[model samples]
Target chain A: MTADDPVRDSLERFIGKPMGEGAVAPEEVNLPMIRHWVDALDDRNPIYLDEAVAAETRMGGVVAPPAMLQTWTMPSPVIAGIAERGGAPTAMKSENVVTALDAAGYVGTLATNSELEFERYLRVGDRLKTTSALESISPRKRTGLGLGYFVTWITTYWAGEDEIVGRQLFRIFKFDPSTMGGAA
Target chain B: MSAGTIHVGDELPVFELPVTSTVIVAGAIASRDFMPAHHDSEYARGQGAPDMFMNILTTNGYVSKFITDWAGPEAMVKKIAIRLGGPAIPGQPLRFSGQVIAAEDKNDERVFEVTIRAANDLGDHATGTVVVSLPLEPSS
Candidate 1:
């Protein structure tokens, strides 16, 4: 059996569970911040650049680009087991397959697929509450060509009075490049 | 935005990084993320940019570590969101940093509001908000 195979609970338990939630505190977003994200992606979507142009569209005031929220970081205090509590890890027991591969000494990995869903446009001042859940964890299967592993996490983002976004799902594969990709 | 762990308008320790592709890939491996946009410059540039771009998850890692590093590992990152403004190209210098804006205590959690950005020569490429839970320091 491949090391990617599930050993304990399904890999689903190892990642993507909700940590907690917070609020936007009303009218909190500053337009400049929105512009910063837009400029970074180099996306020429005019609605984001010009407010009048943005108003012409359904979303008002240069709404945040769908993928923007995913790029930001969460409030994680560096010290462990001191200031806070770990209710449940976004990760599960079986989800360790990927980490396990590295632990067991597997060398390389490859990415296979990803899916993201945007339920509503993220507004500037809207209060956002993010809730997450572990989606799935599949055992790493050894293919005739090589070996790889896969896992997914589901996050639901909510804004004040609206369900703004849903599901940022990610997946990956691991293999010895020397055997498959022919690399050192 | 808060007097907790940070004051309003303080530039953080630039999420302390070279923002390298290795860091990006480490995040992908941790999450088992496989998106052509993250790993392949060819696929990434085919869509846009001069080369492959860092994944949002990797960006999040730096961002997460940035604050957590300050708050200490024990702190919990309740929620975070980033808006991708520019691409974090591989082999270039980038900064992951932010400032505290507000603080609240709810359900025994010391909630902090922070505005963070990943800045580079290209200007700020990413910006977002963070909500963290931290331990309280005993009054002297």
Candidate 2:
């Protein structure tokens, strides 16, 4: 239950620090991705694509699905050898807490929570950028999967000269699979 | 489904999604999440997942749709907070259900908190609260 290792001591330094540099959206909010999401999920919300219907509603125009907030800034992937890199969209940077945890033997990652808050709906042509900060890291504890630490981070999405658009607080459990002895 | 009509404890219509590789892969690609466990079954098995599963963005999308489908287009989602569990794998249909847990009047809008759960045979894939608002009608 105690996380008194040197690695744990090092991790505490990351709390409240920037995870990395801010990332700009590869593409501005556009119709294509919205349409794709609508068809893929079978979501028929007229406000998402039907401009005429949306114009009559309170929105006054088509707005991207609020949940698509995170998609705008996803790093473009390198298709080849992605699985070998453990499904990371790009090569891992050595300085972040995630890489540090993996290096310290907490090799399994499980997403446990997501809290998304939108300040305003997004319109087409709105470009987004995200800045993330490490919020907290819990001490080692026993979980259903094994022994792990709970890592939480907050990402803020911004658009058009410092106007806040939304925010997401995401949490993951990074555990050591080899520690699954009796729990397994 | 106007601001005047919504009440605490009101249930939203149930929605059932037929999970499939197509669903999983389409959502993953649309969200630009290229993680292999969401698109490659063999890779997922190697990672110890039952199969390629639904990604979190897709789950949030479905959760958003479920609320808007019932609350109508005028509703705006303010927040969606959920705790994830179990995998939403192919061949199992994920059933979506929800209820208005609290409702209050804010300036120019009526805010409502909805508790939702998306479950399949494996177990509850996601469970949490979504906060949404609808414009209040102007006084005549």
Compare the candidates by TM-score and give the number of the best one: 2
lDDT of 2 by residue, A11-116 (tens): 9878999888778999999999999999988889999999998998888899999999999999989999999999988886648888889989999999999999
In candidate 2, which residue pairs get closer than 3 Å at backbone N, Cα or C atoms, i.e. clash?
none
- Considering only chain B, report the TM-score of each candidate against the true chain B: 0.81, 0.97
List model 1 lDDT by residue over B1-102, tens digit each: 222645556656655466566655555433334455555666666543566667665566566556755764334455566665567777777877788787
Q: Each candidate's TM vs. the true structure?
A: 0.43, 0.97
Docking quality (DockQ) of candidate 2: 0.72
lDDT of 2 at A47: 91
lDDT of 1 at B91: 74
The weakest ten consecutive residues by lDDT in model 2 chain A span A1-10
B30-120: candidate 2 lDDT, tens digit per residue = 9999999999999999999989999999999999999999999999999999999999999999999999999999899999999999999
